[model samples]
Target: MASVALAGCGKSNDAAKPVAAAGAVEKPTLKLGFIKLTDMAPLAIAKEKGFFQEEGLNVTLEPQANWKVLLDGVAGGTLDGAHMLAGQPIAAAAGIGAKAKLIAPLSLDLNGNAITVSNKVWTAIAAKLPKGPDGKVAHPISAAALKGMPLKFGMVFPFSPHNYELRYWLAAGGIQPGFYLPGDLAGTTGAQMQISVTPPPQMPSTLEAGTIDGYSVGEPWNQAAVKKKIGVPVITDAEIFPDNPEKVFGMTEDFAKKNPKTVQALLRALIKAQQWLDAEGGKNRAEAVKILAKSQYVGADPEVIAASMTGKFTFAPGDAREAPGFNIFFDKFAGYPYYSDAVWFLTQMRRWGQIPTDKTDQWYADTAKAVYKPDLYLAAAKSLVDQGVIPAAAVPETDGYKAPQGGFIDGVTYDGKQPNAYLAKFTIGLKAGQTVTPAGVK
Candidate 1:
């Protein structure tokens, strides 16, 4: 992380003031929450590297016990803002987990998550894996080969994109990714399907102890397994979804309404942090890894974090290989938060039954409008372009990235404008306007 001095920020009326309401004042202090995962690097990089201070904002980075705690903190005003799962803001806005208007004006980074399988499970699947003409394991190692025995797959949480990403990869490979029934919120006891949730850092141990056959989680846990020689990374989300949105820097709706300018300024600092990370052909990655490995932060080894952060991936011990863009931070088209990214999460939420009722495509649009504020993000980008922090042409059309997003490896086109039509394309899960009134669902 870059060095930053945390000092009290005084409000400035001349800073373009976002396109929000007039005369919005800067926040006096910001209490930001994050779980210990590498995807939150932008936040850590902002604070440790002084990007926050450069924005004339005084910010405190707090670590929460888990995603739920971090979210509750933000919702209850215990936290001013936090790093969150890409789906958290959408889920909250759509009334899935906790009802609220959650806005992510900035996307932290992308492609940092990977699916890991235990050594035993890896061998079991690899044995049946069809070898390529070059004698290499073929892409998308499937679960159809391991169906003979029962196995518990793990996810970070049911509401987590980690869960959906894992589920998506499994289903794509001809395996059943279990969906929790509506209001079945307690735990996943009997998931006969291929994937489920385990906390990210614990993913390695859970697989090692045979509690689960495999898991999908963010670094450095996936790489940690390779460091420990306990498991092999099966596939990355980058492969499954292709630059799929992984994490976002989220703020509560109340915060946005009350402190819109503060939100934009905060976004400005985060965007700068991202550009720094991607600068100089990613030469700053080693410094970023040192910060993530601090005992108070991710607390993983620098080399382990590097395995993914620096674009090198290790599936198993002594099995390290070059996998560039494995963990993107501070660069690429990584900073802009897209509305279509919001729609994808909504589609997955509905697919897995977290979204109980059938919603129309218009409803999807309205819900997306309520969160994923690219308008605010554009304000920051404009500011960066003016400040010479970023080039203007590098910005993708912020109008929307969802237009027939057919580039998914599965060849399914997802146009956020027609979510219901997109939902119907899936062979699995309840389609639009469809409901599974499972057992006691009311």
Candidate 2:
């Protein structure tokens, strides 16, 4: 396994001692993989801040080139687990891409992605966008601004939240981002705006090269564009879908079954790292930016990473705004792996024709339950609580489902229990009886 030499970050006060004693961690030495994204903070912080070491884990953190390589590493047992897109394990269970019985026992963080457009595209649409009273473009700029324009956009991976959030943002504005046909792996059939894949770090360069007019990705790539003067961020994923689940610590089900104590130890360390990240209203973020700027981790400039990670998001030059919720690590039950979060991803999979057929609501629920092991999350959280590491309230008292949420850009409500009903409300995307074909939606 390719490993990065981590720079030292002295242990935080909260992480100085082992919080939970998961007796006899079956595996003390382990290797994990992650893409170079800001959402991978939990893993990096855990390693640098000595949280992993406190929990008796000798973990090696490696940065993969892209999401596909990271996912394949985790699924193939080359790496033990990874900072994975929330949809990866769900797609695996649904047989959408690769087939594996992967499990997401804990969610990593929330709301760290944004959609950015090239400067040329932004200049074209800026003149038409209505301005608010402050003489700036009104917030939550809709995809309608690009209507009737033939454009191509990039996302990190087929099963990435970036893809679904971009599609959701576009479809909400009366544009069809396209669907996956039975034989069409590109998923551009019937597309009004073509969407394709690009690695996260390459987004800015890809946009600058004119290969894609825009892209949806996690920081600091979006921030990198604004810094490099290559593109302008139009909208954040939080604006598209509020407090949405993003990345999760994913591993094969077999690994979890065989090494239960090790899994709990890993989760405990990650939870501590998350709490440290969000501590004291983000006072620690400056230091975190420096740590993540190391070549082994995010490797972006601290200023660029801080643009989003330190409670502000920059849309364009001179348009920075306070965005405290831009990158939520531990607050508001961020670590708990909710089954509802998994169900929502499954619904999007079916919505975009990745599943290729209609599935009963029960199927969605069963699939979510199979892939999202909230029982394990609770067990890990409980251990921390018992040790007074975290407040009991920090652990959400949820029934594996969030209340029906309605902060969507389009004002459509999403109830995890009613995925089909929620999906049917979309003006675009496949309907209940419809399926994707090379010709068109059938």
Candidate 3:
């Protein structure tokens, strides 16, 4: 177990910390699940830093094998909640995979993923990349460099930000990333580059073995590639989709309903953990990297974990660069569970034929609302504000939808309010009324 020290506020040394409201913690002991990823820092920090204890709850943080097993643990009631892919709750609510009613009241972090290519692919494209004034390769490299090449890429899971971001980057570069059809879950119906699943920790080893030419995954794995001199990270998710929602704190609706107060207590601790992470421009991140490097957590070398966590990322040897927003926790209102974020994932699911059929804009909105519970998020935030644990300004004033924004690599605008129109704007991918079949898109 890691030791986390609590920071002091402006109050007197003798001043006692504020306690939770009467009966705010319905369940005193809880078990949470998480995969071994740097983005899982918030959960580990909350447990180690005594935030959960402050809320009158005891949390046992367990590391699961993969996303599927973690989701299963949450849905089957073995875990009170877990660090989950943003799409897990959305996919579950949409009945695309697991048949459970899961809801996300909190988003874990944003922009911790990157696309890395093996040494062979890097060698092929490095000479062709445009040089900057420094005479080095310009960043945010387009996936067009891989065009006309027979490449197999790896993603962490089917319903993951890695998959969607990889596809978006490929399509933006005029490279077909393939699609999924009914009875054909391979997601490679029409492709320029074939993509398949590779567990996060094995990405570097898999790439070295020539099983995959490249991969899109979260931190440590990407950095591990650079450390081992096996691959170079070409583009980060932040460059692909600036400030994209990455992971969420997910639990079944039944759990949330049965233990509403317990959920509130958990959220309070998580919010505090987020604040500590982004404090002082990540002054606490070094300490966080140590915690995450523990055997029970991410269990990677602290140096590799710090590659992205401490506001810097390495593309290749001697290619370190400032990436202040690489793994955001609380800043930029990252902890808020935005309905627009959920809608964006739904759009990707539809774009790739995972949805299998076209639905009305209202259906998109309804589905987003059903899975993303901003109401619960706000309730927890308000409690923390009232208790003076966090500032009121940390919460954003909104109707649960961000205004139309354009930060994509493709230069296309996305407005959550207009789902079908957004789908239509894509040059590639299924348009309105299109369904994917095993034979091909129909």
Candidate 4:
């Protein structure tokens, strides 16, 4: 338990009036881990705004070097919980990387990523792009613009949304982003464009050095590229898949089972933080940028952080556009852990050959239910509603599955109930009953 005590609280406050009742918390002090990304805003906001203290929790928000380190810290108990990728808990639960029984009780936000191409690659693609009457490249530029170009792209992790979104975008354009075969984890078996792993912070420099032609990553890295005159953001993930689930607040199942009350309290505070972040048409976004720019937090320049956080993403140096829902936190029921979101990620994993065997649609549903604990999310939401912290309508009433959504750039409808059928609709990715080897898909 390596923990730094947050200011304004100490051991002396342990005797102060508790939120629920004295001795209600099984664990009072906690350390949560996060990577240096803007999507980790809820955790930062919660800690900074005393939401955690209001719930009788003493939280220390620790910034990990990267997503892998952050996930491992939560698994090993070094961190009580973490701001995790939507796929991390699913991948770990399926024994993909560092196997652990991690559960995501809350979804952090929706759609905070963009695909950025290096200046050279952008220049080439821009030449082919059709301009509108305003003399700017069309919004939601298709991946087809970069077709036939020999390029290498980078993502933050193997099982990250960045990889899947980028792959989906390329494949939609008839470009093979590649597959992950067993014993060959490089993920470039039959790729038209080679894909590699690069830390989020290093994406701009890596692109500048011509190591990777483009990259799909979350903010403020994408915004950082435009600020540095190294890359141009072609499209946001919201364009690829509207309101796509990005990150989740994940914890080891054991921790949740052991500290039920504490987990509830933590969720309560986080929900409030999310509401605040998305409140008033983003009135507090500027203040959030300042907090996230702190040395101990995201540690990025405030201007770069504000580029996307303030509802206007800088696609190019002077091409800023209005993107109100760019970084949705609490609106549209963003905090609720929808199982359909988990099933969608699993479909991508299977589509990319991460799951080396065929699975039933029921398997997808069961796995999603196991990792995405919407029951717990509802409980937390109910608690908040009881306390009048949030409106009842803010929490959706359902069986944990969202209605069939058809916002994918490829124009394919993902029902979540028919994963294999949805997967078979893709002409690029591995289909059902197909397995990938070092040689190729067999």
Candidate 5:
């Protein structure tokens, strides 16, 4: 089965010839799932650019109703894998939401999400916000600006970057986003502003209908709001936590074990797609946005998708800014599943009371190592490097933990090796002996 790469992808037909290296895989056919968000670009690119086919894979990309369905599809074997929240596998491994032995072999993307407020909310707080030198509202508008107002925000999933970023932004500005008791799934206990779950595609409409005053989600949904004039994105996830891990290519641990070769093929194809996405300084993004705008994929207008995908992000109708790193697929080691990245998500889960009890730093590290399979990822990456498909420097060399990182909006540094100490620094979350209750943090 021979196919040419998509136009503007800057690849020859020979690009797909690396599949022979994978040998005969145990499973050649795959059914992968994704939500309708822009960060799912690598999956679309893999299928559209025939990277999957090139890697001896017959892959079917299905759009799921929501994150839960996508997660269940993978855990239940309906989907071999999925474009999942980074926290999904970590949560699953920790028995938080759905208890299953899931693992993230590859990270899908970084920093493609943003927090948007309804036009009503924006209008109410716009004048109070300080302006930049460019005579526009200053960027990274603090959540403190909306502190006194009664607001309800939406996130795609409870264990999602959207939820944690929204909470981090709010808590940084001294507003309690709340805690999750063992039975309290709502996570609104002691919250100044209520945050709840709403599917990604419904976020814009939900804001327009005034059902929720604001939301945190991946693009082009946030950009869709700007296009529809329904809401304005105040801050991006990159602004909240720079180069933060967003989504991952996740499957059940059993599936990975049973299909090691097949998993390598999948990772190889996906890594190629990611490289193409960030190639030539994002020269392929226009075609990527066009592919994502199709009915079966993201199903949004090309203009809307391009609003965030093509080197710039639209905060409002006229408020576009250069954000070259917004939807990074492979650049800056985006595809590498760092154990420290896993540990960061685990820290947030514990900080929000999703774990419901204290966990030692070593427990966090062990849990992260169990869930994030860097060995598997490195195996695939090494193959690609051996084939000269990617640069040797593309793969990061580390002992799993990243150095102390400090780009958070709150100015607090995070070290994956110090989860408990990091949790104690937060003024709004559960501390070492603290636990969540029906009343509040106890």
Candidate 6:
């Protein structure tokens, strides 16, 4: 096993180590894949800050060409685990990928995604936002403002949260958002929607060419719009899915079962890294940006990363606002991977015809328990907690989230235990055994 030194508050956990340390097991070296984006910060942070080493893990961090390549790496086991969309694992297990079971011991990070509109759309919408108390135009400009305007926006991929999130925000706010052509709807034919996959780096140029009016992507592309003055970032993913779990560290379920301790140790180290990020109450953000800038990872300018990661964001030309917690890495109970968060992703799967038939609340729970291993997280937490590494208060009960989840842009109250009821509440999209079958399937 690789020897990893773990500490918190800059104090060595040697005393607490023996108290909470689990049995020393063989540490397997892992090559993890990630797409170059700010939300991938947790993996970079964990690797750079020696959190992985502390948990007796030897980890290799690699940048992926795109989301498809990243998901393929983990599914094929060329890479052991990767920073993957929460939906990727769900889609994979439900036979979307290779029909393999993928597990997430840790959710990599949260809330660094946004939908940016072209210059024309921004100019069109800018006329409508309420002139705020500060003379700056109001934010979270509702999609209602885009009514009757023929808009063709871009999303990274069909099954991506970017697509679902963008669609959700538009639908909830009374916009008839256009759809992208889906490559395959589980063998269903005909055009799915208008959304076609545009890489994050190409999103701006595509919009500028009038090929698309807007795009949903993660930073620094969103920040690039502000820095380049080409377009404006209208809504952040946080606004769409408040404190939603964005990415997860995924490994084949067989690997997790065969190498259980390694997965547990990884979670322990990552949790420590996450805790350190918030130490001294989150004064380490600047340092985090530098690590993300190294050529091996995101390879974006540190300033672009810092703009969103820090407390400042540019909505339009010279329209800066204080958007603290916009790309939060570890603060605000964001690290706790709630089953409700898992269910929300599943709900979206059903919403967009990806899931086909509606499933029960228990279906959500079963899928969640299969992918999100809270028991493993608890084991890691217990080890760190008993070692006195993190304050008991810092580590929540690890049982679940608050009974009722709020902060959604929509006025929906989500309870993990009641997913079917939640599905019934939506006005748009499918619900309750509503299946979309291919034209000739019957």
Q: Scored by Cα lDDT, where does model 1 land? A: 0.74
Alpha carbon lDDT of each predicted model: 0.74, 0.90, 0.89, 0.88, 0.89, 0.71
Q: Cα lDDT of model 5 overall?
A: 0.89
Error of model 3, residue 89, in angstroms: 0.5
Worst 10 residues of 2 by lDDT: 1-10
Better of 1 and 4 by TM-score: 4
TM-scores, each model vs. reference: 0.89, 0.96, 0.96, 0.95, 0.96, 0.88
* Model 6 global lDDT (CA atoms, 0 to 1): 0.71
- Residue 308 error, candidate 5, Å: 0.7
Worst 10 residues of 4 by lDDT: 1-10
Better of 1 and 6 by TM-score: 1
Question: Which regions of candidate 3 are displaced past 4 Å?
Answer: 1-18, 21-24
Those runs of model 1 whose alpha carbons end farther than 4 Å from true positions after fitting are 1-25, 186-191, 194-196, 330-332, 439-442
Clash pairs, candidate 1, are 2-48, 2-49, 4-50, 153-196, 154-196, 155-196, 155-197, 155-198, 274-330
What lDDT tens digits, residue by residue, belong to model 5 across residues 1-442?
A: 0111222233444464444445588888789999999999999888888788777888899999999999999999999999999989999888886778999999999899999999889999999999999999998889989989989999999999999999999999889989988677989888899999999999999999999999999998999999889899999999999999999999999999998989998998899899888887887788988899999999999999999998898998878999988988888888999999999998998888888999988999999999999999999989888877788888899998889999899989999899888888888888899888888877
**lDDT per residue (tens digit) for residues 1-442 in model 3:** 1122234322221342436665667777899999899999989888777777777777899989888899899999999999999999999988897889999999999899999999999999999999999888998899988889999999999999999999999999999888887666879988888999998998999999999999999999999999999999999999999999999999999999989989998998898888888887777889899989999999999999988888788998888999999998888889998888999999999999899899899998999999999989899989888777777778899999998978899999999999999999999999987887767678
Better of 3 and 4 by lDDT: 3
lDDT of 4 at 420: 91
Per-residue error for 270 in candidate 1, Å, reads 0.4
- Model 5: how far residue 35 lies from native, Å: 0.4
